[model samples]
Target: MTTSTAAPPPPPAARAATPPEPPSAGRRRQRKGSMRRREAITGLLFVSPWILGFLVFTLGAMVYSLVISFSRYQLATDTARPAGLANYEALITDPKIAIALGNTLYYAVLAVPLEIALALGLALLLNSVRRGAGFFRTVFYLPKMTPTVATASVFLLLLNGSTGAINRGLAAIGIDGPDWLLDPAWVKPSIVLMTVWGVAGTMVIFLAALQNVPKELHEAASIDGAGAWRRFWHVTLPLISPAVLFNVLVLTIAAFQIFDQAFLLFHRTTGTGSSDASLFYAIYLFEQAFRQFNFGFAAAMAWLLFVIILVISIIQMRVGNRFVYYEGGDR
Candidate 1:
């Protein structure tokens, strides 16, 4: 009875009362929050330059151009006056635009497949070589590193109709070489040849893709009595389809934007060639923007080209997804 009476139970409120958090614990939490804020500020500071550059140079310019496309822009006066869709109307009415677009399409059709084929062939050859492989690879890739102007100059000499090495070689073989640069039929082919010379880059891509193909698949195909042709057609081609599609898409885009080679070859301080065969879309856009000072028209042309590229890219990607094989599975 004395022990029971020694202490009464504390009140429920007192029993439930909890001790306050330590002052050090509160300070530590505040320090953690401050450290997080500092880290966020540091990250923003580090990326600020890139953000500013992109906004000013890329996005700002794009927005300005878009606005100019809907106006009559005079570069001489640096003025842009609203003109509605008049600039875009020219795209439909101008025959030169059609001709330029047709030429670009033709070049893309010819160059893309040829580049892919040649690149694949070279990649296959390089992949098969065991000795002097690195040397051969370097030798083949050197053309891609050559300056475009220098390459165009050398090709200008090599493609001379009357006395160039190419025609001379053709004569030696008892065949006549076409006037590559002068002839309308051959101008694009000449460009294609020049483009193929730089196929070393695409070839390297294909070579990497080919090398990445699991050797075990090939060995298994061989064990299954698959012939060389069968193994290549079934096993090798599927594995490399993604690379093939990628190269084709890239080459197609480059082909559409062909300006330098055509300009250097067919256009000069004098004038464009007799035929309009070499007047690519990019060349037309340049002429509109710089030569004619029709910035509005040039902007329209740029937007049109952008739309075409975007649509074509979308189509290619959609089509490619069906055929391209990912290791894990299609995404």
Candidate 2:
């Protein structure tokens, strides 16, 4: 007993310490090198089509067009002579170009704001209707679903100067309906009016956004003694601002690229000699590229349009932070 109690066995020395157990298969992991490689391959494979299409069809063409813009280009002509930014110079100085730009700006300013307001109003109205909502939504959305070509014929007939329904109605009311498609002053306005019909999709978008807003916010505002107008002004508007901005961006681009309406309307109502009045941007671009055989100049115009769009988008994105409200916005 005394010998046993003399001392505990000496503690293991550092040299005699046991080694740590190796991890089991579950606990152990591969080096991650192969896993990373596999993930990268998968990502590339997933995006391969986009990359391939962009490279082959889009990228090269875009770059080549930009290059050609500095020169004079025609599909039939093999030689491209550099004009040293003369195309840009002409864009700024040319009177026809100036008129086109004015018309383009006018259309965009009128159409974008009008369309957005109409869409928002429609959304608000539709959102308030609980019964027969599906039917109303379908009715509202039918315009957008109709193909532009299909709508064009009806529009042409309605917009006809003498025999059209619009003129007949106006005449019945003792107001003469002006020649919408024929008169240069009225042609652009007719385009605006007709195109507003297809704005149903934007209304639907705003409606969806409005519906997604939580009822609690409205209730809380009411509890806080906010009037209906006050709640809408503070809560509803800010929340749906992102959607409005979206509509504005899309509608503006579409307005700028308005070709079909202008072209069809022009071909039907006014055969092309020169129309500085009905000079929407896309129609002007088409006329320049094909009719005038100034593809390079048209490409330059296209690039300019792209820049305008980019700048506008950047402006919208910058401005949205002020008015747009997200659920977790304050933090």
Candidate 3:
């Protein structure tokens, strides 16, 4: 009784509690691999439409054109016959090809610079606006919304050598405006005017680039006794050089393929000597393909244009990369 019941037998020898087992490495690796595969499948699904369209429409057409370039399509038989390099040979021997190429080159040189300058100037003005900026931007962009055919029609009336408003204004100033559409000397310039009218797209791109520039940099530039011109030239220009490069490359390619304005202005009058001034490469290619039914020659011309554009684009990108300044010092 004094001993009380036997003290409970000493607890079983203490055993350390074991930690829960972690997931096996193999299982972990399998889960991560599955997740990545799911993500990749999702990404591919998102881009599938674009991939399909490019394959069917763009790549397919390019391949077909390449094939047809080496063959003559006989209208009577409605078939293509292999002609080897004859079509390509015609490109070099044809005088009209040189003329068309010269005209296209001239237009590209003239239009690219004008478009860049005008677009940049417009962007600068827009960037300075604090009030009614949206309204002004809309007004400026309206021309781009206009259809090419409608714009061409309006230009015809404006470019009429005799009764045009431009000529009347020149008359008021006691200066004689040249026959814009008819005169060989002024025809290209007239087309350039039309091209510049639709430069709002480029201006908008510049505006977006300008807005992205750090305001602190500009403030610092101003504090350094840099005037507006100096700030723009030294600070703003370098900051926005990448955008300039983009616009330049785009405008150059577009200028090379210019067709609508030239065709609208000169197609009807092509037999007339004055229309010769507007005989661009694109228009000539159209003539060969549709009017003359020389599909093989036209295909060759298309390939030649493609080559020219490819070469020029490569050259521009390389040169532009050297000059373009990005925020991180990488182009």
- The per-residue C-alpha lDDT of model 3 at residue 134 equals 97
Please identify model 3 stretches exceeding 4 Å from their true place: 1-21, 24-32, 268-273
Rank candidates, TM-score, best first: 3, 1, 2
Ranked by lDDT from best down, the candidates are 3, 1, 2
- Write the residue-wise lDDT of candidate 2 on 1-331 in tens digits: 3555566888877686776767763344554666888999999999999999999899988898899899998767767899879898879987877787788889888888999989899999999999999999899999888888778878889999989999999999899999887788888888888889898988989999999888999999999999999999998988887787788878878877888877776754556423777877787788888888888899899888889888877897788667776678761
Q: Output the better candidate (1/2) by TM-score.
A: 1
Pick the lDDT winner.
Answer: 3
How displaced is residue 5 in candidate 1, in Å? 43
Estimate, for each residue in 117-222, the C-alpha lDDT of model 1 and write its tens digit.
9999999999999999999999999999998889888998899999889999999999999888778888889988888889899999999999999999999999
Q: Kindly give the stretch of ten consecutive residues in candidate 2 with the minimal lDDT sum.
A: 24-33
The parts of candidate 2 lying over 4 Å away from their true place are 1-22, 25-28, 31-40, 268-274
How large is the C-alpha RMSD of every model relative to the true structure?
6.5, 6.3, 9.5
Span of ten consecutive residues with least summed lDDT in model 3:
267-276
Which window of ten consecutive residues has the lowest lDDT sum in model 1? 266-275
Per-residue lDDT tens digits of candidate 3, residues 14-91?
899998767896789999999999999999999999999999999998898898899997555679999999999999
lDDT of 1: 0.91
lDDT against the true structure, each candidate: 0.91, 0.84, 0.92
